[model samples]
Target: METANRIVLPAMDMNVSEGGEIEQTEIDHYVARAKGGAGLIITGACAIAFPYGAASMKEPGLSDDKYIPGLKALADAIHAVGSKLCIQSTHHGKVARIDTANDRPVLAPNPQDYSYSMKAMADCTPEELAKMGAATAGKQTTFKTMSKEDIDWLVETWADAAERVAKSGADAIEIHVAHGYILGVFLNQRDNQRTDEYGGSLENRARLACEVISAVKARVGDSLAVIVRVSGEEYGQEGALSLAESTEASQLFEKAGADAIHVTGWGRNPFDNFTDGPLPNKVGAYVESAGHIKKHVSVPVIAVGRMLPDVAEKAIKDGKTDFAAMGRQLLADPELPNKLAAGKPETVRPCINCYLCVGESFFDDTPFCAVNPSLGNEKVLPLRPTSASKHVVVIGAGPAGLESARVLTERGHRVTVVDKADRLGGTMWFSTMTTPDNERLLRWFKQEIKRLRISVKLGTRATGALMRELKADHVIVATGAVRPKPDFPGGDLPNVQTGDTLRAMMLGTATAQEAGFVLSTLGKTGRLSGLTKSPEFVRQFTKYWLPMGKDVVVIGGSLVGLELAEFLVERGRRVTLLHEKQQLGLPLAMPRRWTAVKDSEAHGVKIHRNVKVDRITEKTVEWTEGGESFSAPASMVVYADGTTSAAPFAAELEAAGIAHDVVGDAGAVNYIHGAIHSSFKVASEL
Candidate 1:
């Protein structure tokens, strides 16, 4: 039952199964992490009832012996690499879509009464809503209160599932009572209103979970270890399980023979409070809760929720928790553990915490990492040596260009990266001021560039002559997207700013004329110096002093615009955001996008959608929506729009007869995710 180390890969759903059977894609996904040196690997949620109580058809199942071969295959593969495998067994109670699809009422502790806000879905397109609806076959969810017989069936089902795990040769079986699953509903007072033995006091509410844990342990004996996952705290719901109740529950679980307690948190409202729990956006989210539970229970406590390497190491060293369950970090770089063990932690690619991976699970689709292109599809990841190494010139030192150079060097190709900007991370550098998590990625890329010894030419713009002089066998143009000034009336006002101009002003790359008097005044006040080059310093320094006035209006509400709006609002500016379309945060993943909109609104950012800009005056922005004229007072107007894909160098390379390809925003404007994925695709081939 013991693992090689304290690092555990907790259950992260990979909706890649086929009718309750585990496919090789899922197996390969786990195998890659195992090979990458994770001490313990836990499979995603496995339905004990299969198609009957499953959330999606892609979820692995343990209802029948027919599924044993798939589980055994995964177990054997994980064991081959000296890592222990733990199968997470669960019954997706209220969220079970299969039950709704078959016109069978999904099991719940009681009839559902609470509902979450749908305002977050206002920006979702018809296609996105349709894809989410397809998960449940477009059927309305109905629930049936679990009877006494139903509770018996559930306990038997969990025990049977654990027995199959032992038969499949897994090291442990994790009984999932967390994240609003079957046992979780009975554990929480918010969902469980029944006055029966299963749902009254704290112990009564914990009865079903302890019963199932004891049953599973008895059935499996010592052949397999038993782990129980519980929500240390539930967010966005009244009367939900708190840290105190969950800590006592952990003690009860230990008495019921749970060898380990995996502490997790749940956000009751998926749309509004996702970042507050489960996959939390904050670092070390549940470490404190897990540490509290550890003091009450004698067994090991596993803490999860953005458990990055440094956070996990400190928690373990300080005896805060027994193990750190990393889900997204391992997905970003499966080699994280190996790299850490080798004392080369800088090589570990960091998960930017963009929520792109978990967003796919909302639609019942396979999750993929933003930094790692080969997540679910791992077979395509190995850096195969090229038959002939050639000199390659990658234009622009942004994410796309840097990633291309890194991959090409791994494939034994000589690469030279050239950029017009003085810094490495083009627009991504500016993004660090708004979203600090991006700083980790920028630092990682910088370290990789230094580690790989790749040639980088900053302040050197790429051209056909430069490529010819370098004698490049291949050329990759990643100059990124173009942000032109809007063609509307008064768009050229002195107080107005475009994306390029805004970035330049923030980075201190703009001239006094381009930045106007306000920014020039700030520069003359000795604020713009060598220290301003650090995004961290500027981000903090701006909270006290910003060049812009108190009132600001941002046009366009997409990813960049929304983030900028939030940033400006947080900086004490009365911000009004206007969008031409209904979607506010397009191209950002659903969860993160929903969070951005909700947070911006909560913070008093005035958001207007489906609006047409009529003009931008010196101190006001005029727009029309639904045939109604509207105007907002603004001291500074930022036109964070008119961005289009433009790779002018591609045509130049073409005319010169030099082999080349376009990647990143130049090929299409998907931002960072598109940048990394596109660069990897093109670079791997070259």
Candidate 2:
């Protein structure tokens, strides 16, 4: 039952299983991670009572022998790659949508009023809601409070599931007692309210979980390691489990035959506080709690929640936690452990904390990584080796162009990257100012460009004549999108600025004519000592010395506008955000979108939806909502809209009889996800 290393790939629901059986898609997904050098791999939530108390039909099942063959295939595949496999067993409890679909009441320890703010859902489109509703077959959830007989049935079912795991040849079984599952409900004071033996005190509340754990351990009898997952702390709710309670629960479970404690956290309310726990946005999210639990337990403690390699290495080195579970990071690049072992951390792709992957899981769909196009379709999307080497010219230095160059070079092609901008990471570099997680990705691309030693010609725009002169066998156009000026009145005013102009100003490349008085000051002062080149320096430098006035108005409330509004509000500006559409943050994933809308509102960003801009003056912005006109005082007007996909060189290349492929925003504007995925697809083929 021993693993080769301390890195653990925690369970992340692929939602690709079929009727409680593990499909090859799910098997290949885990196999990829094992091949990438992870020491331990945990399967996504497997139903102990398949299709009965299950959340989704797509989750793997261990309730019957029919599922054993699929499980065995997965175990054998992972073991052959020198990695240990652990199966996470659980009954989804009140969150089990399958029961509701079948008209059976979802089981719970107690029935109480449960509600959360729907404000976050205000930005979700109808299509997204429909997909999410399809998980439960459009049925409303109903609850059934568990009785003593039900408890006995659950305990027996858990032990039976453990037997199935042992027969499947897995090294471990993780008992689920966290994230508001059946056992977690019995452990948390907020969910369990029974006046009987299973509730009323800490020991009573922990009794059901301990009974399940002990039953599973006894059933498996040292044949499999028993890992217990618990929420070290519950957030955004009163009476939630605290560190003290969870530490004590860990000790109690240890006494109840648990082999290890895996510490995770829950936000309680998904719509309002998801980023605070579960899959947190913060780095090293649950390390402290896991450390505290480790102090009181003899078994190894596993910490999960945004455990980046550096953070995990430091935490383990300092004796904070015995293992680090990297979930989304592994999805971004399964070979992270292998790269680290090879002492090439810079070569590992980073998860940008975009929430795109988890957002798909909310709809009971397969999650895909933005950086890794081969996430779910591992076998199908492998990088193919080219038959012969050829010179390839990639036009642009952004994420798309850089990625295209990197992959082309790897496939035995000589590549030269040409960009009009002086540096790499086109708009993505500018994006780091508002989204810091993007910085890691930009840095990764930079490192790759340098490590591969691809010839880069910056500040040099590609032309038809230039392409012919370079004599490249092929060309990839990733020049990005074009941000046009607004057509509305006052859009041409001196104070009004588009995303491109603003980026130029921040980069110290904008002329005095392009930048108004307030921003022109930045170009002069920020360019000194190479300060403006660094996004971090510019982020902090602008906080105190930003030239903009207090009151600002931003036109458009899509991804860029929403994030910009939030950023401005953080910098102490009163921002008025206007959108002509009903839903804000259109292309952003639902979870991140919900959090961004909540955060923008929380930061006092005045949001006006379904509005048409009438005009903009130097001192104010006028807009009409319904039949009424509204005005907001604005000293600075930012037109964060009118961006469209454009590749002006495509026609010229076509006429010259040059073979070219258009990718990224230049082909279609889907932002970073589109840029990376499109680049990978195009480059892999060439």
Candidate 3:
């Protein structure tokens, strides 16, 4: 509770809790951050009540005294490490999935639309569905609109939760009224159509928030700091809480006993709120929202959403708000505060805005980072020095190989990473041409390799002879995948290339597709890339500046194809993508799939699915859709279909009788998350 810095580690659901008790994994996670020097650490939101009000059983609970001991242990762990701990309490209303509590009713101000959680509750017994709170899936199940008695019970629940939080040794209590949860549901005029005292005008609509605050304050008094999270502007729903209404709500909250106002944005769909517990929209995406609320409130304000250290520090220095809350950034690196204090931001692995953490946490309580695989396993998996260190040779420079090398070195092994390219990132580097945010990941990995003093041999394609010459104890074959040679008539024409080949040529790195066996020439590779002045690389890629003509035909409709189409369109090229599948993005999550299709369409790329390529000439491509055949003018044809293992490379290692294991694309090709996770598992074992 005492003063430190203004940095706040806001509550993020760390899907590790089980049966309403915090798991040891979750305890270890918070303790790791507390040791890393966060000023304040807020536990993931705990349920104020059971079954009906709780979001997920995997999330910790404060609904009863039985949960106190686990909360106490979590608090003591952080307190002993010199960090203040806060517990967030919530009632999820209709959003409650009730995965474990099939007997609890789904309550809301009014009947709401369907959600993933409600659908899951449908499989409950018919007897259970008849309960006041039970839900049945595959059919329309409306909410049990809260009665005045229900509202009073919720108020008492908050006060009880706050008392329990204080007894558990938490320094502060934050009421969850943001992100379309139960409390937020009551605040939204659109959701609450009640003619009762709790609904109607702005002040009337906010009566529940003020009442909850007053009740909580009356119970905890001055023993705990009270904070309320609110949506400054609910953009997602019609006639939801607006900035002006929420601004007035903030004043009323302070008057009712809130010590701080936490501002967040809302989307039309409560499940997918903008920029919080979601992929960050942009740097300081919610700063303006916080600033607006801050002007109207006397209490301290916390601004969140993809805030970098420099940006957070500046906000404090400029007095835009009192505290900066970082969720995903801290999840990426728990030592973020220490890194900033030590002025070593480059060493910090940045979040790539991938919604894996969010998607995982919501669907299953197993949130993990895309760039940092060590997350979510802080208690079990480790990088402790091996009892007997082995000399390790890694045969790729992509994410998988890089991760293997990093962990191998941490295990006190002498590590050597060899790649055929002059860069550290394998295909991930080529991906940065469209997604520049991930470019920093390459830097972080390069920095770690340098810090650990691992040997990196770029432009050195590992061969059996090379492995034998190294006399290594162990070899990790992450040689990665290669583009398939899909045969089409006249495909051998000069303008035809795979997505990888085109990307490499454009980035000033001549691909093996073009340069052939010479890619094996071992050249001095640096961590930094300077394409504009590298004479050798520039000369090799000179003819590739305009490799494709204006009109292009992409031969696949996979994720790779969609991305390639976007990149091509950004460079003023007209693209037509042909795929055998009915959908453009096959086997991707809805968020990722929708984004790919949206960006592709926004770029005006023509897409024809269920099409079979008939033939390709130097200047045109003939393809069939349904039962119809058509020919289109195309000056270039690019392969975006798929890839197969770099099989020969692994076979060479096997033939030499060497002790090597293949990870990632060399064994399996599942793109980024799969490749990184596979490498982490293999490297940890090594």
Which sequence of candidate numbers ranks them by TM-score, best first?
Answer: 2, 1, 3
Candidate 2 deviation (Cα RMSD): 1.2
Candidate 2 error regions (>4 Å): none
| lDDT tens digits by residue: candidate 3, 16-67 | 7888888889988888777777888888878888644766667888888999
Structure candidate 2, residue pairs in collision: none
Model 1 regions lying over 4 Å from their true place: 517-529
Cα RMSD for predicted model 1: 1.4
Model 1 collision count: 0
Cα lDDT tens digits for candidate 1, 1-686: 77888999999999999899999999999999999999999999999989878988999999999999999999999999989999999999998988888889999999899788888889898999999888888999889999999999999998988888899999999999889888998999999999999988989999999999999989989999898999999999789899999998899999999999999999988888898878899899999999999989888999999998899999999998999999999999998899999998888899999999999988998998889999998989788888999999999888998899999999999999999777789988888988899888999999989988999998797877888899999999999999987889988888888888877776566777778867865543433456656789888988998877899999999999999999999999999999999988988888889889999998889999999999988889999999999999999998888789999889888888999989999999989999999999988987
lDDT of 2 by residue, 90-187 (tens): 99999898898888999999885767777777788999888888888898888898988999999999999999999999999999898878888888
User: lDDT of model 1 at residue 136?
Assistant: 82
TM-score of 2: 0.98
**lDDT, candidates in the order shown:** 0.90, 0.91, 0.76
Clashing pairs in 1: none
Q: Rank the candidates by lDDT, best first.
A: 2, 1, 3
